[model samples]
Target: MLSLLLAAAPPALAHHPGADLDKMMGSEEKFFQIIDEPAAPPFELADADGKAVRLSDFSDKIVVLYFIFASCTDLCPIHSEVIADIQRKVNATPMKDRVQFLAVTTDPVRDTSEVLDAYGPAHGLDAGNWMFLTTRPGQPDGTTQKLSEAYNVRFEPLEDGQQMHGAVTHVIDRGGRFAAKFHGLRFDPLNMVLYINGLTNNVRKPAKPEPGWWDRLKVMFL
Candidate 1:
């Protein structure tokens, strides 16, 4: 699976008091993994309006990132709908300002600006904090697909004009670290909302323990 592809990189350093916070946030252990060195591979792409958008642009917000093609008949639309549900839930809460959504096209060839622009509204995705990204005309054709691979989502074009791919929802923390991921289409959207809430409020429940010198040494070696 695409998630396995990212295992080559060293895990992100989990924050202190993570175990208590994880439980308090209601984060499902099976669906979400708190990366040790939480950071996402950076990329710059053009939105539907041709504006250059980069990951750094959202450094101050918690990013809900995913990949889809406008014409996809499977997975993409379902994922967007699920995200839309999550968006609505978040927007109803105070954490709305701290959260943002980004969907980059895997099939940039057919997902033109006009197509990309209409996709969100058609799928019930709110425009207030969401943006659909695609490669510009002069950019390489495989640009978005390469970006997907960088996020561990391997998008491959098949002869039938559809794509063979795995689905995952990436949650990038406010500080720009690729913090956590909710794998597959079946994960509850509320689970994501809870996780993002925990991130936004910096929930460090149960307090961080001060590691002893021996504990630090063990962490360095193990």
Candidate 2:
């Protein structure tokens, strides 16, 4: 069976924490400024089967990175449902062979192998083209805080033991660099396919890390 591997991009890239704070504070667009020069941070986490995977492993394919905990009640579920829809839509496109989806769970304590093994198929995730990952405290790539900070995700474990995070999807080119970013509850994977296809023949580099959803979410809540 064919399978996609998750990878850690590289260090030095470690997103400059809070650097986007100024930009986000200013613009109403609220998307990461699209640095377009930095590569995705390197990472190594385990797949549902307990096998190690890295962002670099998908060097020649498109990777969609998003943060979510399995027990999410609202946006996460909506985001995931959109992802599944995107997957179905992409299967009919020419970009099918070139895409891979990576869902990283911020709540590792609860999103372990057993959790993923259980969550994988029920939610329309195809282990061959899509991989679900959760990093333990000492997984050797980067810390949860580092990854969360890099991606700008602020996840707090609620009393009910559910995860709260900003809803955003990270679209990384095959070269392991940031490309387009899509936000909001609704998703359009075709936009991702078009960008990847256009970028395939050009020089790719790491762009800036996307911002956290907490600030935006707070805005919505208020």
Top candidate, metric TM-score: 1
- Write candidate 2's Cα lDDT for 9-121 as tens digits: 12312442234422432253444335454587778887877778888999898787888878887877777777877776555444567788888877777677888887767
Quote each prediction's TM-score: 0.81, 0.69
Separate clash counts for every candidate:
7, 14
User: Alpha-carbon error at 67 in model 1, in Å?
Assistant: 0.5
In model 2, state the lDDT of residue 210.
42
Angstrom error at residue 58, model 1: 0.6
Off by over 4 Å in 2: 1-33, 136-142, 187-189, 200-222
Model 2 TM-score on a 0 to 1 scale: 0.69
Over all chains combined, what TM-score does candidate 1 have?
0.81
